[model samples]
Target: MEIIVTPTAEHLELDAARLNSHPQNESRLFPDGEVYVQLESVADIESALVVHSGQPCPNQGLAYLYGLLDLLTKHDVLITLCFTYVPYGMQDKSFYPGTVNYARALLDHVTRYPVRQVYAIDPHFSHRDWVAEYPVSHLHAFPLVQQRVNADLDDYVVVGPDLGAVERFGIPSYEKTRNGAYEVELEGGLDIEGRNVLVFDDLIETGGTMVAAYDRLKSQGADTVVAAAVHGVLDEGIQRVQGTYDGLYLTNTIETDAGNVATESLVQTALE
Candidate 1:
């Protein structure tokens, strides 16, 4: 059985190639008895299944996805659509009035295609049931991120930028207080002091919040500060705080020129 991977700017080919080596009963239905094909902007088809990682930006648009759908439909091939949500910062719930339901709207738009399955890493949804509109697969990136952090760091406390993340990420986190600007408070007014801190979130847009968190952790006597997210959307402010934190780990859910402090080692495990 062969597995073909579609190419995007993201460095997922190595991991995909690794996933191809393992055989599954699901491969029996493929044409020529081969199960994998990879689709990329550059034509280096190494697997039996075609995987296309076309740019989905508005300018580039969904033309590639549409084309792939047409090809799959014509050939009667079952296709799975896999993507992550860092490029577009998905705040599942609206914080203020007149804000758009970005996550739900995006899913609705993407599901309009004829893909059989949808795979997502670390979505910002409040509940899994919110994605029930589409009859496809959705994978959470939190457990994967947690596993990576847990493997790398011991004697560490999880830090959340705010209370929202504490609930969303399902971990104990320190809330950044408005007054101190560089202070994070734990439950019962306890502050994280002299402890190794691991800050986890779904995405990092600019480095503002993260940088502030780093300072706050330092002020509170956190021995070291490490920030990890599923997506690294280093926008304009990233330059200001690139070196502020000790380590910034992220997954290859989006394409970015900004190098990650660490790449997720749990890619292989997540596939399982």
Candidate 2:
């Protein structure tokens, strides 16, 4: 029931007050570029939940993660790893001949350490078999983001950016057309005319999908468009989509100024 946070996870500001609190874990280099880890207090722990933000700085963050995992396994502590934004998550869908799936490869590397279970928030992987093996627990920030956002907002509809989402969310979604403008066919009994639109995806690296959805929704006579996602690895995407959408939000999965929503509720239930 103890929560051990990595340096990168500090951005999440996770609300795990219900879980047992322990001394912070420390990490530094050995001058050879190798990572070293330590517990601020004595390591008499039994069960632990290691929360880490694994994007933006995957290599450095992973060094800390592996070091911490190595240290904990020595104490025979039961571990459940939580990566707010799973690394190498994008390559799980479709494969190229003679190439390896980095997503599965890296996740396998993680499971190598005596880890019991791993969890992530809205992983980008769509490969059914790979996802079935170890997905993000099918947990998402949609409901939480929806609940926290202003309810007095305009009439809203969730736009699935892909066919998988269109089937999954059972709502009208947008697809790309030959002309580069997104097309919304108005399925699932929801129309974009004069109503606010909400479109989301697992990750928002460039914000093109969201911004495009906004443009298409407005073209279809929608009032306003709110863009959202679970992870906002938004390097330059933030500046690009800032003023265009009526609202923009990302869960605090990565360390960014724009992560307005929190991801604690989705995780607490599993830990307890």
Candidate 3:
């Protein structure tokens, strides 16, 4: 399959697409607030894309993606997408009527094209069945996490921070109460005295949950309490997670400082 890394997704440096080959892939804007885009040499081929929908400019990213899709769909190219960081993925649920589930909304918009499959690294969703009708599948980052832990971390047990994580990872978990968007309280017991603890989850936004987990584990006499997550989207989290924990391990999904694992290999894992 011919692979494409869109102009919006150029920062990932995936081996699949060579940006230099498509010198004509450029963008401009109209006098009005509109975007003009062009992607060269991607027509009439089966293709895979690499892109991340990170913030501060998410609308621009999707606009560029839609541009590329418009050009490629002309020749009926089969497409697969690697959304490294899904935009608005955390908004997967709605508690009230008329509340939009942005996750589902984005999925609908993404599948409007002839996409065969979609691979995301540990997508944040409350349930899988809610999106089973879509061609989206999660790329498990836990295997890579296990490899990293086995190579560097010793005498540590993987602990899920809440029931959702417990169901996803099938490990011992902590009871958590969320007071607000940035406030977290954890309650649980484990025989972890003098042993290292690794709290695993999909994403961390404000770092409140991880910090609460760290405090709970340390209070139980654990030697080291580390935080591990696939996506490090720390908007206001760097301070809360940096000095408070023994260590933080994350993947290159969002290009954060704590990202130690390369998600390139894990992308290939999706094909398997």
Candidate 4:
């Protein structure tokens, strides 16, 4: 038997509904915001699949994951972690003085557990040395976003929010653009005038650059602006832009109130 555990029931609801035979743990939270797992009593459990939707409280989620690992390891069960959004993944570099390598730190901490494998979606790390303990499956977010974009939107041009995203969205060189904290810069002097645009990025934390780019595209006469990302860690960024955007679509990676595109199938395949 394979048991699926997550920090919250909501995180694994879609998966559980799909995999009806797999046993699962429902997480409960105390008044103090501590997380606890309620496991269904079973025998002959061979492995534990810990699914994590790293948002709202990533540390608390980690605590639950660690606790589950401890319990399962005592029974000599194999363990795998399917973390949709790696916490502090963007902190891959010490940009300047007083900065810490949070990516390394987080990877180091998680690998301390006896995890047989780790699965993540488009982790931002440029190096893989931190994950030396176990094999990691790095999944791409582009195909997921592309399928949704093609199915939902018509008459839209995909806009990469940064130079790095140009290849991901397959935008033409002339159409490529770059977004900074407060300004949007054109790579090939392209104009978004009178065109419907879809802004794409790997993740949305604070939504600063995306918001700025949306406003700038409108200023340059874009007919409509929509956004899509792999992870939606909105962090007041969605509230900051309120009613201005036509739509916002995201995968169930970090789990916000955004329109969710299913990723449970991806998770199932990863487990296999």
Best by TM-score: 3
| Residue lDDT tens for model 1, 213-263 | 776678778887788776665545344445777776666666665544333
In candidate 3, what are the lDDT values of residues 132-156, reduced to their tens digit?
Answer: 8888877788888778877777978
Is 1 or 4 the stronger prediction by lDDT? 4
Clashes of each: 19, 0, 0, 0
Pairs clashing in candidate 2? none
TM per candidate: 0.66, 0.83, 0.87, 0.78
Candidate 4 structure, TM-score to reference: 0.78
Ten contiguous residues minimizing lDDT sum, candidate 1: 38-47
lDDT of 2 at 164: 50
Model 1 residue 63 distance off true place after TM-score fit, in angstroms: 3.6
Model 3's alpha-carbon lDDT is: 0.74
What tens digits encode model 2's per-residue C-alpha lDDT throughout 156-248? Answer: 777765555654445567554333333223323237697777777666766566666666677778887777777877667765566678777
- Reference-based lDDT, residue 240, model 1: 46
